[model samples]
Target: MTETLDPEDAKIITLARSVRARNGSTEGAAVRDETGRTYAASGVDLPSLQLTAVQVAVAMAVTSGAKALEATALVTEADGPAEQDLSVMEDLHNGTLLLAGPDGSLKGRHV
Candidate 1:
């Protein structure tokens, strides 16, 4: 992980962690739109429908009419984001992806 993190990115990390804790989910993600609005979500794991936190966050942005994203943060136990999650970010915008551990410590990053 980078030694220094942008303040906005840090906020997303915190937001993602909060979502994870509140929902008691395995993962959580937060995304910032071009306009600076942020969205946070925990993984959706219903029997009939399943989606990663990043996927849900991206969908929320799109449904809210956000044309592009500025950055994304994911709090997960896994080492990094899944390929499908990264693809969703790529589809909307080429932005930084921050990965954080359950304790909310930065673990890695992809730009």
Candidate 2:
């Protein structure tokens, strides 16, 4: 976590970590929309379909009528999020994006 991380952002990171642990997934993510609504999801992996945690979280926000995002948090064991994950986050609002390890330590921050 950042030295001055916002409480809301910290909450989303916690939410992401919770879902990751709950689902037993390698990755998890949470997004806060413009309306202050937050969505959390774990990465999906199936024979027919696959999605990164960030992708799933962003999709959830979009499906829930979120016009844009306010913030995003991802918890994963990977060094950082995938390119497509960053792309999807960019496709939405230019909000604060955080990448953290499963232990909740900040790894990277993307706009």
Candidate 3:
């Protein structure tokens, strides 16, 4: 059965795509940071999100970083993102965003 993507999952993909563009790694490694700084040149955000995803997948599968890239690629291709699959993606996206922030973490509640 074809599973419909959850709104949240769709949101994650959208966010990821935006992040990819901001990083400049979507095409060939022109990735940038939130401040528009090129990460490839600075090495602060080494290993693009694509690379990080791979690393996480590998680490989760084998609990090792050796095949992180391979594992992440496999998982991404096979699963993609859907409602049922959104939880993990949300966590991943949120984590990246939080870390990317100026404070490297979310601020206190506004309320």
Candidate 1 segments exceeding 4 Å error: none
lDDT of each: 0.93, 0.90, 0.26
Per-residue lDDT of model 1, residues 9-81, tens digit only: 9999999999999999999999999999999999888899999999999999999999988999999999889
**C-alpha displacement of 69 in model 2, angstroms?**
0.8
Instruction: Give the number of the best model, judged by TM-score.
Output: 1
Q: Point to the candidate with the largest lDDT.
A: 1
Q: Give the TM-score of candidate 3.
A: 0.27
Total residue pair clashes for candidate 2: 0
The TM-scores, one per candidate, come to: 0.95, 0.94, 0.27
Choose 1 or 2, whichever is better by lDDT.
1
Candidate 3: tens digits of C-alpha lDDT, residues 4-97: 5344333333443444445554211112222222211111244653334323332243332222110011112221222322343343332221
Is candidate 2 or 3 superior in TM-score?
2
